[model samples]
Target: MTDLTELGVAAIRDGVAAGSFTAVEVATAFNANVAAAQAALNAFIVATPDKALDAAAKTDKARAANKPLGKLGGVPIGMKDLFATAGTQTTAASHILEGFIPPYESTVSQKLWDAGAGMLGKLNLDQFAMGSSNETSYFGNVVSPWRRNDGGNASLAPGGSSGGSSSAVSARLCPAATGTDTGGSIRQPAAFTGISGIKPTYGRCSRWGIVAFASSLDQAGPMARDVRDCAIMLEAMAGFDAKDSTSLDMAVPAWEAGLSPDMRGKKVGIPREYRMDGMDADVAKSWDDGIAWLKDAGAEVVDINLPHTRYALPAYYIIAPAEASSNLARYDGVRYGLRDLPEGAGLQDMYAATRAAGFGAEVKRRILIGTYVLSAGFYDAYYTQAQKVRALIARDFEQAFQQCDVILAPTAPSAAFALGDKTADPLSMYLNDVFAVPASLAGLPAMSVPAGLNREGLPLGLQIIGRPFDEQGVLNAGLAIESRAGFTAKPERWW
Candidate 1:
């Protein structure tokens, strides 16, 4: 018998339905693995073993009774802490919401439940999903399982925002997890941890009940060990929801069933602007290899220019923070989450005290930047200009897609760096999302597939960006890379 934790979403579903193993047995094994790693990995903010077991039992019963099982039947997964789960603490890795449990479940989580997926637990993440290294998490940093090959033994960062999701799936705590991408939270972490994650076109997954970061940019997707598993989990996680105004009314496509690695007659665009100055040699080599792999799969590789690419990072910083400033304003002491009322202090004083005590340093920094950019004198200069640049970036993609079906690029500029390497310099930290933000701004689907190992033995990922509503194209491209690259590497389980 194989180790149950090694099986991903699709394998577990088929295995459970075929009676090869009970869903409970799979859940129990993963639950133990999660428990064993919790102290070292800190991947999960809260562990709900009972919830997993309970859901598995139901799945097993459904199978025994010959009833129809949902798409995610018998699959247990990690929930990024940003999504509101009933009876579970849904902190965005912020002290402000440390114990805030939503009475209602988020639309995405409910969809997963309806599709028979069980909750493993809420995952740890950057405080308010603000940082690139997961260091800003109130629960503490999510240490990547990968260490450098040089025998340094320095604990590496599992990329931020979705760091815990990346770490857990990479560590085999769960087969898959949910992650929200606002400026590369999903793709960058997947690159760092040697896993697969996809951020579908904007509005593909509902934003309702998920903790707001940047309203327009925050889109949820799946993180898993392979492209097919991501496709399967994504099928279950995405759908139109009336609760969210931005929700796509379009029907959810059968991404898993539609999974095809064949890229015959497909055109893969290589953005000339992606070749950065001072790029890591290993990362550059990986990009080269990805191009060769797509070619091997019969994709025509052509260089395309996205002239606005240079402005993407700056525009993202402005737009995302501006929206975040408005979205996070609800966390005042007057309502839910945290309250720190001073003795005999008025509302204004209490608001100041509570916010000061509640938010983390990075969260505060972003809020201030957000507030400043959206200020009276600077709104047109920063926010409005950024919005215009965003439109230009989208136009660039639209024009590029005319010549190519999908675009290939490096997921991040470099491999997993030592934790805290860029914490002192905010600009360096923000640069981590340089490759990923352009796609997020265009509201396009992008995926990160493990490409190969860097010289230091850390995994590097290749990204596939597709036209809007073409996740299938991105997944197929990812599969082409996944097969040709033969990226079977997982982090050595030091934790």
Candidate 2:
């Protein structure tokens, strides 16, 4: 029998189908794992064990009766708190939304449930998804399961925004988890935790009911222990949702269908611009190894240039914050979520007091910057220019796609860093996402797969960027790299 903790979603489903394990048993094991890992990693804001077990029991009943089993079947997954779950506290890791419970579920969460996936509970995240390091969370920072290669007391950081999901998945608390990426939140955390994750093209997944940061940039995706599991969860999570105006009407593709090893004529691009200075030697080696693996897998590796890469980071920072300012304006004292009651305070004063007391420093910084950029005097200079630059960045990827099936680069500059290492310097923390932001700007599909381990014994991942709606290409390349890299064990101490 496959070890419940170690099995992927696909393996777990197969086991359930073959009567090797029941959904109730599988859910129980994962719930236990969540409790164990939560003490060390601080990954979850809530763990709904009773609800998960009940759902899993229903799945087991259906399977035993030879009734229809949904795509996800008995798989248990973690949800990022940003996605509203009915009756659950959806705080978004900020005090502003404390005790806020939605009456309805997010479209993505509903889809997962409809597909028979069990929810382990809401995971922690950077406050308002505003920071790159998990330290900004009001719930406390998430520690990476991986430690320094040399025996040390270094508390490693699992990357931010989706840090809890990444940490939980890496720690084997759940088979896979849901994450939202506005500007590299999902991919960066996946890279830091040494797991596999994918951010589908914008609109590929529904945004309805998910707390908004940047409406245009925010997208929900899956993070898992491996590429195939990521593929499995993504297939169930993506679909057309008429409720979300921006949701795409495109048919959800079979993400796992074309994952063949035959890459004989596939053209893979190595973007020359991503090779940044000061990149760690181990990361560089991992990139080279990934390219070698692709070439050995019969894919043609070619150098491609995305000339606008230099402008992407700046443009994304401007655009995402500008959108955030508008989206977060709903959090006044009169609205849903937390409200501050100050003695003798009028309407405006009450609103100010509530926001001041609720929002964290990083969230406030983003809102301030966002408001400043979108202000009348600065609008044309900052927000307008950033929009134009975003267009240019998209065009760069469009041109690159004509020459290659997918583009490859290092997922991050390095593996997980020590907690508190970059928290004091916000700019340094933002720089950590330099490599993963360009794709988000272009609204392209991208994924991170473990390529190799650094000298510190921490894992490094390679990113694969695909054309719009071309997730199959990205996953195929990732599967190929995954087979070659073959580094499948979690940190020994974590186990």
Candidate 3:
């Protein structure tokens, strides 16, 4: 029997097309892997084997009928918890939304299904997509299948919000998974897990049914083992949606078909702002290696400055939470999900009690901060100022793009840390996103490619950021890094 779980999106598509194996066989293999790894990785909140088998059956029927296979035909993938999957529970790793299953599907997931992808299940994530580490998940923090090289057995985090997606993809529990990047959720996790992930330019993927984290920053992308797989999945996930006012009304480019190792005449930018105080030596070295790889691939290396980078993290916290406060307001106990109503309590009392009991600590903290910043008295002083700073940050990217085609930097300051290492200090946890947040604030396309492993054998990622709606350029640059880095390390099957 073939180890169908080891095949990537492109390989699976070709195999299925060639009748090397039935789609049902592929789905069965992955479903069993997901079931076995659930306890150890905590990757999936729920497993939907029936859905996978059903989709795979359809693919088999189409092949039997001599119909053209869909772009992702017969490939099974994991859906992140934030994306509503009609009948399956779509909790964003929060207790408040526990047992809540949307009647509608997220645009991205629906598109993936239309392209013939099967769903293994809804993956876990940080509650409300609020945390930088996976520790904020209500179900439990996801443990990376990876371990230190020198003999320590401490369980490390797979990075936040999209941590489950990263863990599953990295562990080979699934070939690829859908991930949402709101302030680095997708990239950070991908980096930590030694996988490739991309956050398409804002609005590239419709946000209609995906749980809103930061309305502007939350973007759906693919997390996979390599750049080619990410490209294949991303092409199937991105398109315009009339329901989403912010959806980009543009043609979805065939990114996978355009994948080329040739980087002749491309200028890769190394931002001076990314060199921070107290930076990890390993991360710095990995970044230097990435630059060398790009140069070797025939791309010109240039130095660029994004002066407003320092203000990005602060501005992001403000803007994202403000938008989150507004979007999450609909989740009050009155409509759907958990509702804690004290006996004889009035409407206001019920609302207060429900929220207090239902929301996680991190969600509440962000809500409180958001409400305070958007308060009548403080709005101008904080919210308005933050918006101005956000514009400045965007302008900084605009100016820098003139100097180079794409900017390269470390995805995170360091490699994945042990669970609970930074949870106590919220500020410290927030800083993990410092390197990935600026591109998000500017609504540009950014991707993370596993460059190398740290001394401790933990994965480190190099980020590539491109101009708006230029995911093709970003993916091309990533291919250069992917080709040169040749990162093929996988976590030992400790799980």
Candidate 4:
């Protein structure tokens, strides 16, 4: 019998449909895995085993009675702490929101429950989803299960602010998990952990109850072991929500149906501008191999230039933090979350003390920078200019898409780095999002798929970017690459 903990959502659904497995049994297996993995990785802020089992029991009873099942049936999944879950602590891995439980669940989480997907728990993340590395999280950093290939040290980073989601999913704690992307949280961590994750077009998934970082750029997405599983999860996750003003009113495509191997007559663009100095040679080789595979599949590979790529990282830093500062202002003492008392302090003093005591260093630094950029004297010079640059970056993608159906590039400059390697230098941390920020700025749909491993045997990933609301193109392209890559699940040392 196949191990329930290792089966993908689609496979589990198939098993349940065929009477080969029961939903309760599947849930129990995954719950056990979560308990074992959480002790080592600290992946979750909360684990709702009782809730999951109850939901799974209902699914099993429905199956026995021949009642219709939802798409996800009884698959176990993890929610990033950013999404609000009714009656559960939605801390976003920050001390400020430590005790605040939402009276309502986010639309995405509700949708998953409605579809009969079982929730394992809320996963840890960078506080308010602000930082590129998981180390900035108030809960502590997540360590990758994959060790150093050089045999130097066993400890390594799992990437962030969705690091816990990726780490847990990659570690087999759950078959798949939901994640949010403001800058590159979903794709970066997927790349680092050797898994597949997709960030649909901006506003593809509603942001109603997700703890906001940058309202304009924030998106919720799916992370799984492979592309097809991500497609299944994305299908359940994407839709319009009246609650989120920016939610796009569009039809969610049949993402899994059109995954064809025949790429004949399709055009793929290779952006020349993504090749930066100091890029790892292994990543470059993987890029070459990916292009070769595309050619083998009969797709025309053409080199294109996104000249404005150089300005994307800077533009993102200014805009994301500016929005973050505004969104996070609600966390002051009186409204919700933690309150600091400075021994008979005044209102202003209490507010100041609360923030100083509750927020992590990176969160505070971002708030300061965000406030500065939006200040009267610097508003036009920084935030406004970055907005203009963001438009230009989008235009670059528009022009590139005019020539090709999809764009391919390295997901990150390198694989996961050691913990604390770049935390001290914020700029170096920001640079990790170099390849992903452009798509986020353009509101384009993008996905990361594990392509191959480097000489060091660490995993490498290739990113596929599609035109706005063109998630079908992204998924189809990812399917093509996944088939050729032949990458399979491997047991991590920590697992």
Candidates sorted by lDDT, best first: 1, 3, 2, 4
- Compare candidates 1 and 3 on lDDT and give the better one: 1
Model 3 worst lDDT window (10 residues) = 1-10
Provide the TM-score for each candidate, comma-separated. 0.99, 0.98, 0.99, 0.98
TM-score of candidate 2 against the unseen true structure: 0.98
Please, what are the lDDT tens digits per residue for candidate 3 over residues 1-495?
A: 668888988888899999999899999999999999999889999999999999999999999999988999999999999999999998999888999989999899999999999999999899988997788888998888899998999999999989999999998888999999999999999999999999999999999999898897889999999999999999999998999999999999989889887789999999998999889999999999999999998999999988989999999889998988888888779889999999999999988998898889999989988988999999999999999998999998899889899999999998999999998999999999999999999899999999999999999999999999989999999999999998989998886
Model 2, C-alpha of 25: deviation from truth (Å): 0.6
Poorest stretch of ten by lDDT in candidate 2? 486-495
Q: Pairs clashing in candidate 3?
A: none
Q: Give the least accurate 10-residue stretch of model 1, judged by summed lDDT.
A: 486-495
Q: What are the root-mean-square deviations of the candidates from the true structure over C-alphas?
A: 0.7, 1.1, 0.8, 1.1
lDDT of 1 by residue, 1-495 (tens): 999998988899999989999999999999999999999999999999999999999999999999999999999999999999999988899988878989999999999999999998999999999989899998999999888989898989999889999999999999999999999999999999999999999999999999999999999999999999999988988999999999999999988889888999999999999998898999999999999999999989999999999999999999988888898898888768889998999999988998999999888988999999999999999999999999999999999999999999999999988987999999999999999999999999999999999889999999999999999999999999999998888777777
Question: What TM-score, to 2 decimals, does candidate 4 have?
Answer: 0.98
* Model 2 agreement with the true structure over 1-495: per-residue lDDT tens digits: 556988889999888878888999999999999898887889999999987898899899998799988888888889999999998889999988988989999999999999999989899999988877788888888888888879896888899889999999988889999999988899988988889999999999999999999999999999999988999899999999999998999999887876765567999999999988877899898999999999999999999999999899889889998999899899997868889979998999988999999999998888999999999899999999999999999999999999999999998887888998887888888888888999999999999998877888888889999999999999999999999999775877553
RMSD (Cα, Å) of model 1: 0.7
RMSD of 2: 1.1
Over 216-271, each residue of candidate 4 has an lDDT whose tens digit, in order, gives: 99999999999889988998998999999999898888888766766788899999
Q: Candidate 4: where are CA atoms >4 Å away?
A: none
Which pairs of residues clash in candidate 2, taking residues 3 or more apart in a chain or in different chains? none
